[model samples]
Target: MNFEIVTELSHLERVCEQARKVPAVMLDTEFVRTRTLYPRLGLIQLYDGETLSLIDPIKLDDMSPLWALLTDESVIKVLHACSEDLEVFHHYSGVMPTPMVDTQIMAAFLGHGLSTGFAALVDEYLQVSLDKGEARTDWCARPLSDKQLEYAAADVFYLWPLYHLLAERVADAGWNEAVNQECNLLVSKRGKTPDPEKAYLDIKNAWQLRPQQLAVLKKLASWRLREARRRDLALNFVVKELHLWKMARFDIRSLDKMVDEGFDRFEVERHGSRLLRMVSELDTLPEEHYPEAIVRLVDMPGYKQMVKEIKDQTNAVAEQLGVVPEFVGSKKQIHQVLKWAWVNGRNPEKMPDLLSGWRKAYVEDRVLPLLK
Candidate 1:
């Protein structure tokens, strides 16, 4: 499609200039981040029908000018499945694109009744199937191949045409406002920070642990989270999850031997002794002195029954509405509902905020009736 690859800051400026002139730009990004908390912005592909610009951030110094064009209220940015990219751009540039359109979201709102994958959407609308075999290829690799360039170009190149179709469909179906609302929510950056106090709940074995065990688990989890942020490396790389959980149960006296057996060599090489000291300190603490916060939910009355009923009712409502059950209320919300009952008791009024918007209509009109 005659895509111009822009690897330097100078080329980025030209691309930004063209973007300022275009009414809207179709965009996509390719990144590598398996080793870090942040996705490495390797490639930024944009097309405005007349021009296709491939921006390589690896060689560019600052992308703030491009960020300005994106966040500029006058120009619109179009994307498909843009949630992750929104987060990445916001993290790097401190600004998120506004007045954006997400083709995938638009498709669903237009009563396509499914979140269509980009390739599937392209095939359905444009009658062309994108080659995604290169999707997982390490974008950080040097010397971009022609095949890779074509594949990358296809991402945004077809997107311009695809968005044209989706935008028309959304307008015809009178779903433009709904689609825009969804896009605005996606572009916001408020919910990215993980709350440390609630972090332990994400651990798989959280329910199995006693209060004392949970205290240690919480401490370990918070420590890992803080360390991952501090080092800018992936959490799993800091300390193997198995070793972290096991540390709650096992003392650190045998940590050296475990390290020798290839247990968290990264942690061992970097902060192994400090971790050992932390574990040793935890081991010496009295069980009664630890936070007794892990409440045994199974023993609570009506907990299991309420959970079963909530799930059944949520699925039934989703079926009736022809939407995914998760769109109604997630399983975690059901668990929280049960927890709420355990504490302040059930007030159907509070359930709406606890669930997704799709559930408000159902919970208010249907599911709450079943609860009573």
Candidate 2:
């Protein structure tokens, strides 16, 4: 179990060259996202059967060698709960690891917990207890201690064994294709950049805003998204969501008024004029340019009963599958399905993730008929 810290370019190139020859590689990443829209990659941990290596992205200038190994579709990349890790890779190299296998998804198909943690899976299959104290460590900081290095190495060490165990169980259960298909979907989703125009939809109580106010919120959210990306700052650091909602809902005309309503001085000084201009222009926009108001399904008659029936059916399916109801289909996902089927004039084929791929056979069959 020898672990080598790779900080030089030649050493990384040699390691990646060796890793490319392996059938599979266990991988993990440590990143920080406290102040930026994208997570800043700090370290990469890799275990290619024989050698365990830690790559310091902070010290290395070029990671193209490692990225080449990651993008090699012929080699399998084994990871546990790899959503954020996939994001890190996409941000760094503009490419995602292909032929990837997520043990968490495999565990779900094998009748284990759907959102099982890495340490939990290790303890379950290999009887190893991992110290996760370094889970929140500032990996971007230099001069990492020996104990921290060991913890990072341990993250990917047991993944190799866990991948074997989970693959065997999933294959035995005849769910090999299902797990692979789901992991492919995970990779596809992680590679997509979100539409900044739709960021306002994520705001709480957004449905309560009027058509004109929704238009204002949309513009404000888009501006905030661009600013965050351009400056590499968190969205809140530019302008808090509460203030955005307040500006949209109320008739705050001037900077003084916004400051009186408790907007941050820095935000007021930076983007206050832009916000005011956007709000003022909302009135001049034509009626057709306004955003459509979000109609809550609960407000519609008989929709409550429809929601209850769908929840009961999803729960029954979860019970039949021996997994949690949330795992089968969360409440939010069910609502999205209903919105598509009823309001959006879309069919089950056009529905969201719940009715697609492997989920179609399990959940959609029971739920679609009721919606129709």
Candidate 3:
């Protein structure tokens, strides 16, 4: 309940000035994300084991000091389940916190669970329960209540102690560098933008479409992503992904047909014609421009056998590594490895993340051979 609310640049500087001297800092952010493509930051919390400061992102004009402290190599920035926090930091600062330790990832390596909730870990480790009543409050709104501020401060209050406990286990297990590498890999993902042109490849059931239909899907998908970004709306808010797929599949030729098919009129009126027009232009394109048909990993012959072999080998390697198999190579990561080896086999220019970094350190000699 005791903390400083930093609203001015000078106050933020003062806090960051003191925080930089500490070897490590606990960090968290409160943001409101309703339907927009980006999270609107509201508050930032920092604990240097001495001062608990709630930096008012809404009132603070300059966050350079915060960025400097965050990127400071000497000071470890710690958080729990930092995927979203990483997004917030990357969005506003255009850079991620450095030498970050996601306590959630840390716990996963220590065998607590793959995705442990912060409160659950706190209770399990510290025997203290957290109040999460303000979890859904509008963080961007002014005049935050005492309860809200308390909730915010509670986020970073116990992080240092929690980090201390987890770090010791991680160090004993000799996974400190692994945790650090995983956090860095997570940060690297935020730096890349999703290519609108390839958006259709990610849509469900996209593999069912033929090359010509896939071309239409590609145009529709591209438009949807571009429009979503342009309007700052959630992807589905612009045009539902299913609708894009359906529109491509049916090739509905007119407004009446599009409406008759039950597409939302607002969307039909706003984007239907443009989408249809884009698809029509596809007819003029040469055959080579169409994306190659998507290859479904599940449909490949020997897919089941390959997966079983890989899973068995992964479990073996995971056992040797003394961590959860999912931590080394999750179900998703296994699929990525399969896809990389089979679907993109000819493209040696790329490699799956599972075969990179600390994961590679463990599984490359052991598992990469199995893929070959």
- Model 1, residue 137: displacement in angstroms? 1.8
Candidate 1 lDDT over 306-368, as tens digits, reads: 778778887787676555666455676776666655564775555433343434555655555
Worst 10 residues of 2 by lDDT: 347-356
Question: How well does candidate 1 score on lDDT at residue 216?
Answer: 72
- Give the number of the best model, judged by lDDT: 2
> The CA-based lDDT of model 1 is what?
0.75
lDDT for model 2: 0.88
- In order of appearance, the predictions have TM-scores of 0.82, 0.95, 0.95
Considering lDDT, which of the candidate structures 1 and 3 is the better prediction for this target? 3
lDDT of 3 by residue, 225-291 (tens): 8887888898988988888888878887788888887789888989878877887788898999888
Give the runs in model 2 whose Cα sits over 4 Å from its true position.
Answer: 347-349
lDDT of 2 by residue, 1-372 (tens): 589999999999999999999899999999988989889988999999899999999999999999999889889999889999999999889999989999898888766777889999899899999999998999999899887899999988999889998888888878888788889988998899989989989887889999988999998998899999899899999999999999998867899999999999998998899899988888789979988998888888888898888889888987887767777778888888878887878864566767887778887778878877
Model 3: residues >4 Å from true position, as ranges? 320-322, 346-349
lDDT of 2 at 31: 91
Tell me how far the alpha carbon of residue 346 in candidate 1 is from the true structure, in angstroms, after superposition: 8.0
